[model samples]
Target: MSQKRVLITGAAGFLGSHLCDKFVSEGYFVIGMDNFITGDSKNIAHLTGNSNFRFIEHDVTNYINIEGDLDYILHFASPASPIDYLKIPIQTLKVGSLGTHNCLGLARSKGARMLIASTSEVYGDPLVHPQTEDYYGNVNTIGPRGVYDEAKRFQEAITMAYHRFHGLETRIVRIFNTYGPRMRLNDGRVIPAFMGQALRGEDLTVFGDGSQTRSFCYVSDQVDGIYKLLLSDYTNPINIGNPHEISIKDFAEEIIQLTGTDQKVIYQDLPIDDPMQRQPDITRAKDILGWEPKVGRAEGMKKTFEYFKSLTEEELYKSEHKDFTNYHK
Candidate 1:
């Protein structure tokens, strides 16, 4: 059989870099593409000389052109975090709408199955406890956070349209809170924010009363599940995340213990539209792909913590988060 070739958008970002690593390790010729608005080159720099990998500096919202056969496409390009999407709301919308459209067109022309990464944020402070695939979601289209939540929702709608109307092969994975190496320390996510403060011996910031909950899947487990979903026959969305849930306040306490820092948790006002509860049902992933998270929070956090501790003093102290809206305007 000929070697399989794959295109991974956002290939330099956290999850995208990991995905490139997975495919290359599996002997696939991987094309790693990223616009780098929020992605760091350091994340994928190690693959620089690897024969099986090629890096493309381009945004998916614009036209995409590749030279040869592409067996699959993982359209992971988007401003994922609140810090990112809030800073570039227009870019976020374009990537979700225009970028997704470009990728679907490429997939159609190449006869390649495509997978667009969706998020549990679609569940938007969900009325359901542990979200399942059928739950539509509770979202505010006008809220500041809506740019991201609605984009993914719209992304899902278009994906299903492609599948039903055009006979295109498609897969969707509703990613939950994920953490590990390469997560930005100042990107305004719970895990990295807490870890960065702990590393610097500062108080861990807990938004809201800390009762807001999140389910974090280790990077390995998440990547493995995505790999399975792409190859599987299931075209609908599947939730891939650890079922283990932790309250934000309690998670702050866990970090205190993990880092053994003298700092204590401090409360702050909740961000607008933060989810009160989040945990994936994952019944479909369990039954269909036979996949469940193998790494516990403690074990995964250990690996993640060590990575943060290894960051340079400059990176650890980098307080400013870049905003590209001015440039885009």
Candidate 2:
């Protein structure tokens, strides 16, 4: 059999870049497409010369026309960070709605199996802990964060429509908080936020009382689970994340220790609709995909710290002082 051809949208972003690398190493022809809206080209710069890897500057919200037989499509294009989505609300909605539509259509036309990257945010501010895939989320549609949350919800709905109505092979993996190398220092996710602050010897900002909890999954483990889901026949949404929970305050303290920063812990008002607690129940992922996160938080944090430490002072400063005012514009 010929080597499989895989198309990954948002191919320049954190998870997408890693996915491209994995496919290339596995001897698959990888087509990575991104608009550079939230993704940076530098993330995939190393792969520019690889034979099995190709990059396209395209936005998934627009129609896609590609040559050759596509064996699989991974629709992961969207502004995933809260700051990013809030900065470009319209773009967020479009990527989740129109972009997903285009990818599903392409999958149908090419007879390729597809997987949509959904999020644990689809659960909104969960009323349940250790959220199972079956739990209906408690989302606020009118809130500031609604654009991202609802867009993901709609993406899942339409993806399932294609699967049921069109009989297209489809998979959905609802990712929880994930962090590791390649995560933008200014992405505004908790891990990056804390790490950036500690690296700069600045006060660690903890939103709200810092009692809220979240589970963090290492990026490699997240990519591994995604690959498993894509190769499997599972049609339902599988929760992919580490179940080890930590309070926001403790997470901050851990970062301070790791960075050896004496920075103070500062409390800020929680952003609108921030999930108070998020921990995935990955029973389905384990039983079906036979996947579980292997990297412990301490080890993952050490690797991430090393990556951040390698940045130049200018790069480090930008990561630490990212402006959020124009995020939506």
Candidate 3:
């Protein structure tokens, strides 16, 4: 049989690039799409010469075009970080809405299975302790983070609609705090923010008195879970993330220890609508996909820090003192 083909939006992003690599390794013809709004070309540069890999420079918010037989489409295009979405709120909303619509249309035309990258943010400042797929989120629709939160909530909604109405094979993965290599150093996510500060010999910034919690899954495990979800017969949303939780204060200390930095952590008021407790109940993923994170925080952080340390002096120090006051990822 001929090799299968898959189109991955946000191809140069941290997670998307990794997904591209995964699909390519699985012997799929991969077509990666991105406009570089927040994605960096370097993330996907290694695949430049691969015969199975091709790239398209286009924004998914606009209409998408794919040639040849396409077996899968993973709609991951959007401003995933607080800084990116805050800077381009409209684009974030458009991609999650209009961009998703376009990808679904393309999937319909091509007779392909579709998967969307959803987020834990859908459960905005979640009232539930450990979020499950059935939990109706407690989101502030008009809040500052509403652009990304509502965008993802709508993404899931429309994806389900397409699955039901058009009979389009669809999967939704509600990703939690996933960290590994290729994460932009100053994206305002806690991992990169704290690590960047530690590398720069600066104090780690912990917003919200450091009590808010987060659970991080290593990138490779996240990719595996997504790969399994795409191939599984389940049609509803599934949470893919490490359930091991830690407070911001504790995570900051871990960074300091990992980097062997003398700088202390300073606390500030947490950003508005920031989830005080973020953890995923992955019972569905385990039951359906037999997926669980294999990388521990200690091992994953070491690998991640090694990658960050590989950066040049220019990347390490760029925006060294950028305000992390709003860092709540």
TM-score for each prediction? 0.98, 0.97, 0.97
Q: Cα lDDT for residue 69, model 3?
A: 90
Model 1 residue-pair collision total:
0
lDDT of 2 at 131: 99
Can you list the residue pairs that collide in candidate 2? 87-327, 87-328
RMSD of 2: 1.8
Report how far off residue 315 is in candidate 1 (Å): 1.1
Q: Can you give the lDDT of residue 26 in candidate 1?
A: 97
Candidate 2 per-residue lDDT over residues 1-329, each given as its tens digit: 99999999999999999999888988999999998888889989999889898899998877899899999999989989876887788889989999999999999999999999999999999998889999999999999999999999999999999999999999999999999988888678988888888888889999999999999999999999999999998999999999999999999999999999899999999988899999999999999999999999999999999999998898888733334454343
Q: Per model, how many backbone clashes are there?
A: 0, 2, 0
Clashing pairs in 1: none
**lDDT for position 205 in model 2:** 93
lDDT of 3 by residue, 31-102 (tens): 999988888899999999999999999988878888789999998888888988887778889899999999
Candidate 1 TM-score over all chains jointly: 0.98
RMSD, every candidate, angstroms: 0.9, 1.8, 3.4
What is the Å distance of residue 83 in model 2 from its true position?
Answer: 1.2
